[model samples]
Structure formats: structure tokens, C-alpha cells
Target: EAEVAQSPRYKITEKSQAVAFWCDPISGHATLYWYRQILGQGPELLVQFQDESVVDDSQLPKDRFSAERLKGVDSTLKIQPAELGDSAMYLCASAGALNTEAFFGQGTRLTVV
Candidate 1:
């Protein structure tokens, strides 16, 4: 069985510094999603991809954040000039067209120091 993969279970960065996180979605899944989870709050959708096309990114902060899924399987999220308020758990997940269960990878806990 394929699984989502994320790097650096924990990350510490200085305020206003650049940071990046990576994810590999499950094989054969066409939809991939990135989410941000703040302490004590439910995860919120950041962006989503269907194949190589962006399906929804209305919640993404284009002014400070960007993401890409090249070839439609793996993806990267980047934040330039991170701020103290950017600290959160970044989660990667994917679901098949017929599968409703969104499988999440162990998230990268980002801390802006």
C-alpha cells in the first residue's frame, strides 16, 4: 500500500526566514491536499490538486505562500519570510476519486522562532 510522505517531522526557523516542506502523496491518487493545523484548532485547507491541475486554492495566502505539484505526484510548499504567526503543523494528504477517507502523513511541525 502506498502512503503519503513528509520530511522533517519538526522544523524551527527564524522569523522572516524562508521555509519549505515536502510531501509525496499516495500512488495512483489523483487528488492531493495541503493543510495547516494550529494548536487546538482543526486543520484548514491550504490548497488542493487534482492531477497536475489546481482544484482549489482559495484559502491559500498567495502573497506569502506558494505550492507546486510537479508531475502530479509529489509536491512542495514554500513560505518566504516566515513570521511568528506561521507556526503550525503542515499536513499532506490524498484521496482517491472513489475513496472518501483522506489519508494524512505525519505532519511537519513548523515553529517560527
Candidate 2:
């Protein structure tokens, strides 16, 4: 199976604290995405990048969340002054130029107290 690498699989942070998660997609994939999943719910798209440019981020909370794929290979997602509602699984996914069948990482489990 193809792999997308994510770091710090688990994170515990206090409310109003900042947190960051990282992902490295498959070597040649050019499309990447960041998603947030609440328990018992489907993953929700937070951001999408085609190469280094953002394709979509309408669902992202601009007031506190940000994501980037600087060189179009690896990406980072950050949340500042996180709130209790921010607790969820952050997942990273990648797809080829065709943009079909994305491969996903194990995801980072975040708990904001």
C-alpha cells in the first residue's frame, strides 16, 4: 500500500495553545489535502493543494487554522489558540495528477483541553 507520512500521531494540548502537524506525501504526488474528522463523523476537508498553490480552503477556519505545501511535496497544518472543539483527527492525503484515489496517512489525533 502507498503511504503518506504524518508526524506526532498523538497530541495533547491545553485550550488556547498552538499546535502543528506535518505530512509528507508520496514522492511524486502533486495534489495534497488536509482534513479534520470528529468522532463518529466523516472526515471534512480543510484544505486542498495542487502543487504549491491552494485549490480550495472554504471550509477552513481562517481565524485560527492554516495550511501550506511550500514546495508541493510536504505540507504543514497549524492551529493557533486552539479550542476544545478543535479536538479531532487530522488526516493528510495525496493523489496523483489524475486526482483520483487519494492515499491517506494514519492521521494525528489531537485533544484540546
Candidate 3:
């Protein structure tokens, strides 16, 4: 079965430090997403990837956040100089290459001090 894969179920970093999260989307999928969920809020789409190409990243805070799907498959999200306000759940989701069912992985909860 297809499943989204995420690592380091949790992360703690001091303010102004850098951190990165990794994800491996279900094989054969071509659409990937990176979402950030604030406490109690719905997940906000941060970036969307269609294969190795970025289709949407308008909501992504470009100043500090960066993501890439180098091989058009697995992906990575990085935050430079993480901020206390950057603390949140980073969720990786994937849909079919043609936009079908999407699945979420247990996220990486970031805590910035």
C-alpha cells in the first residue's frame, strides 16, 4: 500500500538555529505537499510538488523556508535560523500523479526555543 514517510517524529531546536525535515512520498505518486499546522488550526499548504517541479508555494515563507524534490520523488524541507514562531507541525502529503487520494504521514513537530 502507498504511504507517506516522514522522519524524526519530533524536533527541538533553539531559536536562530537551522533544521531540516525529510519525507519520502508513496511510490508512483507525482504530487507532493508540505503543510504547516499551527496548534489547533487546519493544516496550511506551504508548498506543492508535481514530480520534481514546484506547482505551488505561494504560502511558503520564502525568507526562511525552503523545500525541494530533487529526483521527482522524495523531498526535503529546511528552515534556516528557525524562530520560536516557527514551531509547528510539518506534514507531508502525497496524491496520485493525476490527483487522487492523498495520505499524510505522522508529522515532525518542531519546537523552537
Candidate 4:
């Protein structure tokens, strides 16, 4: 069975440090998304991409966070000068097409001091 791949399942960093997370979606899936999930709240879309082109990123904090899918496949999300509020689960999901079923990766849990 195919699955989304995420690396460094856990991360801990002090405030003001930098951190990064990576994800590789299931093969042939075109729409990819990154979400931030607080412990008690539902996931929030951070960014969305379709074939290397950013489709939505209004929620992404451009000053401290950035995401990229350079080749329209795997993707990376980075946070510079991480803050305590940045602690949460970063999830990666992909879908073969719009309105199709989406698969989610085991999210990366980040902790900031």
C-alpha cells in the first residue's frame, strides 16, 4: 500500500532556533498540503500545492515559515526562529485529484522551548 512519508517524527528546539520537516507524498498524487494541528483543535491548512505551484498559502506566516515543492513531488516546511507557539503537529497530506480521497502522513511533532 502506498503512504505519505515524513521524516524526523519528533523534534525539539529552543525558541529562536530553526527547524525543518520533510514529506514525500504517495506517488502520482498531485495536490499536497501542509497543516498545523494544535493538541485540542482541528488541523489548519498552512499551505497547499498543486504540481509545484502554490495554490494557497494565505495562512502561512511568510516572515517565519516557508514551504516548497521544488519538483512537484516531495516537499519541505521550515520555521526560522521557532517560537513556543510553534509547538504542534505538522501534518502532510496528498490527494490524486481535487475532491478525491486524501492520505495523511504520520505527522511530525515539534516542541519549542
Q: Positional deviation of 11 in candidate 1, in angstroms?
A: 0.5
| RMSD (Å) of each candidate, 1 decimal | 1.1, 0.9, 0.9, 0.5
Candidate 1 residue-wise lDDT, 1-113, digit = tens: 67899997999999989999999988888899999999999999999999988999999999999999989988999999899999999999998873578899999999999
What is candidate 4's lDDT per residue for 1-113, written digit by digit as tens?
99999988999999999999999999999999999999999999999999899999999999999999999999999999899999999999999998999899999999999
User: Which sections of candidate 4 miss by over 4 Å?
Assistant: none
For candidate 3, the clash count comes to: 0
Q: Rank the candidates by lDDT, best first.
A: 4, 2, 3, 1
Model 1 lDDT at residue 13: 99
Best by TM-score: 4
Candidates 3 and 4, the one with greater TM-score: 4
The collision pairs in model 3 are none
Error of 3 at 60 (Å): 0.5
Candidate 3 Cα errors over 4 Å, as ranges? none
lDDT digits (tens) for residues 1-113 of candidate 2: 66999998999999999999999999899999999999999999999999999999999999999998888889999999899999999999999975488999999999999
Where is model 2 more than 4 Å wrong at Cα?
A: none
lDDT for residue 47 in candidate 4, whole number 0-100: 98
lDDT for residue 34 in candidate 2, whole number 0-100? 96
